[model samples]
Target: MPSRSFVVLAEQAQARHDGRVQFRQVLIDAVKPAVDLVYPPRCPLCGTAIAQQKGLCAPCWSELIIPGEPCCTTCQRPFPADYSEAAMVCGPCMADPPRHDGIAAGTLYNHASRALVLSFKHGRRIALSRMLAPLIIAQLPQLEGEWLVVPVPLHWSRLWYRGFNQAALLAEHIAKATGQTLLVDGLRRTRRTQPLGGLGRKGRERMLSGSIRLHPRKSDVMKAAQVILVDDVLTSGATSDACVKALKRGGAKTVKIACFSRVLDEARGQNTAMPETKTPEA
Candidate 1:
């Protein structure tokens, strides 16, 4: 019914409307609410809906104690308020120094931190590693000369049942982030020990003692190599100490630990870190 000229004008108006607005961007923005409705990013620590993935909401972050400066020179534990600023080994560590040269953890293990660690360690939430690896790496000082990133090894039998090693996953992400060479198999668990959860320090140590060793064929390469041990949690330092002992016995020059969380007997109310020589960072 319209004249050709009128028809042309109508088409032009439609084109102008389409061009004036970015339908792609508009559509993307419009669907975001729907998209968010279907899939929202939740905090890794708690299920609270957060703005982004791998987020620890403000409350959770505040509740969890992050390790910072003036840590122990040996064990890297935070000092009690009265003893802050003095860098010395806690009595517990001084009683018998850990075999590893040094140790550090991203956060003190507590009720607030336990949930996050358990969820990742047992809940099969591999995605949480993205958030956790950074925390572990943050505590590590740069090591001397081309250190090898070694994840605490899991016995093959346990690995078969679990389908994955949490420590190896952390080591993988850490190796990528730091561009360090990783030897996931540099150390192998000689035998499976009982889970360390219900064990005291001595029990744990006894269980893990003589349980780790370097790969027989890889021994030549690892000899004299500095080692960076990776693990999910540091409880009594027994397993780490055992690992360090094995490595040193196998000819590793030095070994240090970088773990995501630590379970210390803070109720004792004493200094927590240990004394050790500072390694020059490369």
Candidate 2:
């Protein structure tokens, strides 16, 4: 059991965090008009000017595949309109059940979404976090129990090189929007692993094995709690699975994955050619 002092201290920390977030929002709101005027909004993909900031043009918007219902019950991979079943589990889920509760993906991996991800992540367009976070939030279900938002951790080397973890940015926005507790350091990457690009599911799993674990101080906070593991992209599911395993190992009751995009090669079938990992953003 946690002590009263611990609870109070936690509350204070959360209050401070909320205050900082609100301050940033206020600051952005204040200067956004001027910024918009200086650099008019344009479609992230095609560079076509748009009316609103952080929005897509009509053609680019059409290219994005926002996932909806008739999805796999276990994984939430969208199913075809004519696809129907009593269990509602996709073929992949049926063959090998997922360890996590389900996935909440904003869009299927497509050219338009790929460009946005590359721009936001690799191109250092941090402002795009605002645009991407909402897509992921729209896919999330209403919460019924206590839920903690946690980002998939990055190793020290990666953090130092990248300056910021893209997943953490998304997770922070999600926690703020959903009114959930954001445990920014809930999980920690134990060591640096090679990128998962060009790797098969088994190969990726092998690389991520024992690479992620719950933060020592976060065990109590995670115990019996429902956790939302956030990431920018869900490719092979290897990374998210490792994070979920760590959360459950730390006594979390349930873990769900929320991501900006998901690569559904199985759902899309052999006809659709997809990139192996797509910038190692998984």
Candidate 3:
């Protein structure tokens, strides 16, 4: 018979095979029940009870507007359902392309998405950043590449009034979830402009021109770096244009705008038409 001491030692050695025991899983097993008991997981979109974890309720999920192809390859502008594939560039972009390399956006800036952005932006629903960040991340094809995750900065005045920069929050979450290095204060809004909501394209661009610049301290890192620019909404594309110009001027090799929502420019509606070689979904 084996000695009791040796048998006991063998048992301890077997138990000490730590690879067989997952510490994270053990912690989750012990803690999740208590956390769930006290605070249930509610739907991020509607705050209703959900059968599953980490997403919107079915109705809310269905309401999200995801624009597919047959859109502008450059600006990702949405065209009518009958638009053809041959016509990818919008009139504005074709006439004079944007200064930035390209754009990627999560969804159309319809009523549902607008409400979400407003809730997160002005209503202090900061938790929505985690929920909405995946939308922007989905649009990034170079997410895993060597890149800087940069957020459009809010001016100090606006930051004081808003209490937080929504773009930075989104960028942080994107970095956390994707393991990307985030440049939290990469861009600084040097000059504040009036709200650009109602401004025409030219007016918005003019207002934002020379308004943003690369952080002096971060200039070295930005040199020749591919950048993923995060923002809450792509409105007139003027702010993005200015920021991209600044990024390139600061020596960023490539700048791609990624936003949770993109405003479909109505001015380009007629100009986005293509020949009948490829048709959009009606």
Candidate 4:
């Protein structure tokens, strides 16, 4: 017969093994429904049901106004019909050059695209990134050299409030699709600045200046590789410019900006030109 101590040890070991088995079973059961649901998913923009996984229905996908020919290479702005160059730089870019080498965006941030961006940023519709990633990947041929993917960092306070960084999520998806390395911690917003929305161009630039800091450990990676800054939206470009400046200062060989949407110049009407009246400070 076994001694008392030996019996206790055996019982404890058996209990641990049983617990592990039960935990694994629970995990399997929990994940099965999620996998099934993803196969026939709902559209992130319109909430319409989709038959395929990780995509909008065919009609909604077709309706998206993807950026086409005659766009500014630096800013990705649509140019007038008279402009015929494949790499047309916008007037602002020509006048005041950005630190980054180039900009690539998936779509114009018009009413249709805004719906998807708002859902992802405000409504926590993270699944929308699946649809957007491929669009970003299509622009990868335009990128050159050994590139690292860096998402625009959210201030820690805002990150805590939202429980997630939408840009990071989008960057992760893009990284996965393109097989590019993602350096999420390369840049961080050390001091929370005023909201860029509603601010005039100068105010927006001022708010972003000196707001971002590059991570110390990522210095080596930044030095060795080109970088692609990722974000969900591009409004005045001030925020991205700040990130680009920080990355370059940290020794990034080159930097480019990519986003799901870019705000059109014409869309910045008089009513929306004013910055928000007030925002919480960090």
Candidate 5:
């Protein structure tokens, strides 16, 4: 029913649009090599020059401790000796089961991972999400069904001060990487609590007892849903435990804690106290 002249004009416009898009891409391709020559990519962590961008140097990469199988089924901590069984829970977990399903950590807390955490959190290196999210993803177990990616919420006060939630940033990347739905406001902080550093497990528990809860609007979606609760670091297991409890109360079928770094008791020489690195309140 349309006129032939109108059809021809529309086709011409589309061809022009496609040509512009191709020209823009060609320009970008041409400029990228010049930009790389002027400013070569370097290691994000150690500042050592590297062949590619957003990659770590060999020495810095080696310093990171990536935990693998032969780990506790509940906490995912590597066992002391090689065990034949496919699944094994540690003695501590056997004695008292954890509320959350399990923990998947990118790396064990160490000097190298510590620097990454510090820069991502306090230094506001938001771009690091692209580099850091993959580490957590590599450690994540194969998720069966649809899983919701939820970041541990930041208090309004802290969120306002920092201008961004590092966990949420990581969750955004994780959701995209895994093709999972992201619920940025799945959880909410009830109030701002004191810095949880230097606190014992019991002390941290008390401080965070009612500090986190499910966002009211997301309660329906959370019901019986699988969730990946994200955080930058896992220390003392107190904050993460609290978040898990909140998700469980919201009827989340299984809530797995995924983090960039995990502070392990064995890594701490079995000391109960946390290390000197700064720990942000959950």
Candidate 6:
């Protein structure tokens, strides 16, 4: 018979090896079940099951209007039918050139895209960022250089109330996809502003003016790096412009806007006028 001490040592060794084997098996079992149950994630836009991962279903993907030729060079907004692509400036960009050098958007802010954005931003569908980020990255193939991505910041009070920043979530995914550095603290909203959805172009511009500021320490990084400001939506381009202005003031060499959607002015059915701003009272 084995000595008692030798048997105890042998038993301890076997137990340790068994524990490691059991742990590995548990992990494999947990992951295997999930893998078997996996279907392509559903489209946030149409709720149709998508093939592969982080993508829209083929039909919905085909239906997506990737903004193409004849867009505004500076803003990436679709230009009027008669506008020339070589013009380099749309009427709005010429009239009031944004502080940013250019813009890139994943899709037109039309009915389908609007549904998706609203679901992700307000419905707490945080997983939608996984699909949205890849689409945005697909549109920005030329995105290279010493780039820093900064999300449009939400006020601390609003973030606390909402429990997340949709833009920040989107930015995180983009940073992960592109291997670009995310400078989350680069921009901030000093005051809470009313949602700009129903505001007229001018009203939206006024509301966002001077609302964003850059951190003092990141001025050196801003001076040295190109910046891409990420946001969930673009309406009247006011928020992006405000962010660009602040980044430029902090010495950013160039600033560009990248958003998931852009609201079209002409799409409002009969409600063409600006609605009253409903800011929360302090």
Q: Quote the lDDT for 70 in model 1.
A: 67
Candidate 1 accuracy as lDDT: 0.78
Off by over 4 Å in 1: 1-37, 81-87, 267-282
How far is 211's C-alpha from truth in model 4 (Å)?
A: 1.3
lDDT by residue for model 5 (1-282), tens: 899999999999999999999999999888987878998987768888888657689999999899887899889988866586877888889888999898999998888888888888877878888888999999999989899999999999999888899999999999999999999999999989888877778998999989999999988999999999999889888888889999999999999999999998666665334432355434
Model 1 RMSD in Å is 13.8
Per-candidate TM equals 0.79, 0.85, 0.77, 0.78, 0.85, 0.77
Select the stronger candidate by lDDT from 5 and 6: 5
TM-score of predicted structure 1: 0.79
Model 5: CA > 4 A from native: 1-31, 34-39, 269-282
All candidates: CA RMSD (Å):
13.8, 4.9, 10.3, 8.8, 5.1, 9.3
Q: What's the lDDT for all of these models?
A: 0.78, 0.88, 0.79, 0.77, 0.87, 0.76
Once superposed on the true structure, which residue ranges of model 4 sit more than 4 Å away at CA?
Answer: 1-40, 270-282
Off by over 4 Å in 2: 1-33, 84-86, 267-282
Taking all chains together, the TM-score of candidate 2 against the true structure is 0.85
Cα distance off (Å), candidate 3, residue 53: 6.2
**C-alpha lDDT of candidate 6 relative to the true structure:** 0.76
lDDT of 4 by residue, 1-282 (tens): 999999999999999999999999999888867876765567665668766446777777877778876778776777877887666688887898878787788887666677777666776777777778778767655555557889999999989877788889889988877778998898989997766766667898888778898998888778857888998877778788888889888888788788887777677773433122222331
In angstroms, how far off is 159's CA in candidate 1? 0.9
| Error in Å for residue 20 of model 2 | 11
TM for candidate 5 is 0.85
Model 1, backbone clash pairs (residues 3+ apart or across chains), number:
3
- lDDT, candidate 6, 30-120, per-residue tens: 7864664675456666777654335667776676667876777777768657776495667777887667787788887665676677677
